[model samples]
Target: GAGWPGLIEAYRDRVDIPDGARVVTLQEGNTPLVAAPHLSELTGCTVYLKVEGANPTGSFKDRGMTVAITHSLAEGSKAVICASTGNTSASAAAYAARAGLTSAVLVPQGKIALGKLAQAVVHGAKILQVQGNFDDCLELARKTAAEHPVTLVNSVNPVRLEGQKTASFEICDVLGRAPDVHCLPVGNAGNITAYWKGYTEYHGDGLVEQLPRMFGFQAAGAAPLVHGHPVAEPETVATAIRVGSPASWENAVKAKDASGGLFSAVTDEEILSAYRTLASREGVFVEPASASSVAGLLATAADGRLPTGSTVVCTVTGNGLKDPDTALAGMVEVEPLPVDPGAVASALELR
Candidate 1:
């Protein structure tokens, strides 16, 4: 069971991190595992949200990026590169800036959210807009990284998974054991694999009494796992998860089978509903893809698969501010009124 101490020591000794990498003080793990009584009440289970939005780059990608960039620096690479829907690029840009390395991000043209794009730009990445989708960009990045001096800092690198496994350790620490079930949205599917690895290692080492069932949800339009093949053209409003072919496909399948987990697809409508529910009810404003976990949980609960009073942990992987446009969809614009007290009282419905 390589929980905190063992995992940290293992990462330091086994992983290929730089000897003296400069990491941001705020760039470590230990994100909040907040209780969501509202969601718990609805599901008849004690539901907890692993709020990864609190990560330094506003997504769980920082966990992986820190390790990936550190390894890149250790290898003496002057530049790092990645293909991202949004979060990965932002993380890479920030970490590269911290490590004093140039970052280059390839993104699908007109696909990424404004805030994510802004983060990459502000962090000084050379952002390239590919004419095709995320898969296309990823392919180009892989080829470019292979042919050039820039290090590929994507989830394809094993070090990223090693770093991301820390989330599982943190969850076990807070809950005192593995929850009955763990759910999360899967894009490239590396996160689920990492969680499974963490949980298995922890259980093997006697840190946890048992392993939790992993549940991975993907956007219906972009679900290669459920569909049993990659989509030629993946589409979803949850831009962060509109992946056609996940790079870590085999490892994700291994996680599902090893943990007795389920892989499912949720519709766009369901994703949006969960997004609003997390925002208004649970008071957790996460990006649409992050809501996919809640969507799966609600669906599984409705199907009577989840037991009452069981502990369920859902990983909300990113912050809502990364995609503010989704939050404003179908909303009416309000006109500003005069700055008078009378106007304020009138707007407040005071007679």
Candidate 2:
């Protein structure tokens, strides 16, 4: 009840932790599951936002990072390594710092959001600017971890998914049952894969009556899943999801197929529009990649694909503050008010 004991303690009985292991945490889970009145009205479905941006590091990656870093410490690891577009590195760096371990984050040069980069730096992570993209960084990090003693904490690590699956548990526990549909952004595809695993596990264990369809959306410029192949040079305004070749490709496809969901692409224009709308209308400010879920949901609803009156949850994966430049890119209209009540009233149309 007091701060919720973090996800590891909250779901200790459900997840595995090394015997007598030192726990590293920041109380990352238990994010708000808020109702979206405007989104529901627009889609004709009962819409909700699993606001993962409310996490300690302002992103869902913190959920997995705690467990990954815990395991890294228990395994006698002195350092942790990962390749991240932004959120993952921040999460990893924070957790590793809490655990008193060294962290190295490999990022694609000149492609990361400024806010995310600042998080990594403040958390004491050594940032490596690689010449290639996310996929290349992941490859390099994996290789480095394998050749050295540094532990890799990326989603490729089984423990990362094990930790991420807890999000599904929180959703089901809050709703008293699974929803008809669950939507999220797909980058390296780990989030979708983890959600599917979580839902399926809960269903098998009889925790819920049914599992929801998993809808995954990728940016059009980096929609390798939709293209059915890897794009050597992926490009997108949503840098958090600018992945060319997803490491969890097979599992993501399995999740889509098994859950009777589909993967699709949305353009940057559509993503930004949804991002702005979620902020301006729904009062939910999330990163551009996170808005992809909402974009896909609205698109499918307009196409008569999403059933009316059904329950739907869209996971807003990261905070908009993580990429403020995009939000502040265009001109913002502001009417200057004089130092007078009358002037303020006139500006507010109260006069």
Best model per lDDT: 2
Q: What is the C-alpha local distance difference test score of each model?
A: 0.89, 0.94
TM-score against truth, every candidate: 0.94, 0.96
Steric overlap count per candidate: 1, 0
Provide the lDDT at 320 for model 2: 95
Per-residue C-alpha lDDT of model 1 across residues 56-138, encoded as one tens digit per residue: 88999988887787677767789999999999999999989988899999999999998999999999999999999999999
Give the per-residue lDDT of model 2 (tens digit) for 1-351. 365889999999877989999889899899999999999999999999999999999999998998999999999999999999999999999999999999999999999998999999999999999999999999999999999989999999989998899999999999999999999999999999999999999999999999899999999999999999998999999999999999999999999999999998999999999999999999999999999999999999998878899899999999999997898899778977778999888777996
TM-score: model 1 vs. ground truth:
0.94
Candidate 1 achieves a global lDDT of 0.89
| Superposed Cα deviation of residue 341, candidate 1 (Å) | 2.4
User: Candidate 1: how large is its RMSD?
Assistant: 3.2
Native-vs-model 2 lDDT?
A: 0.94
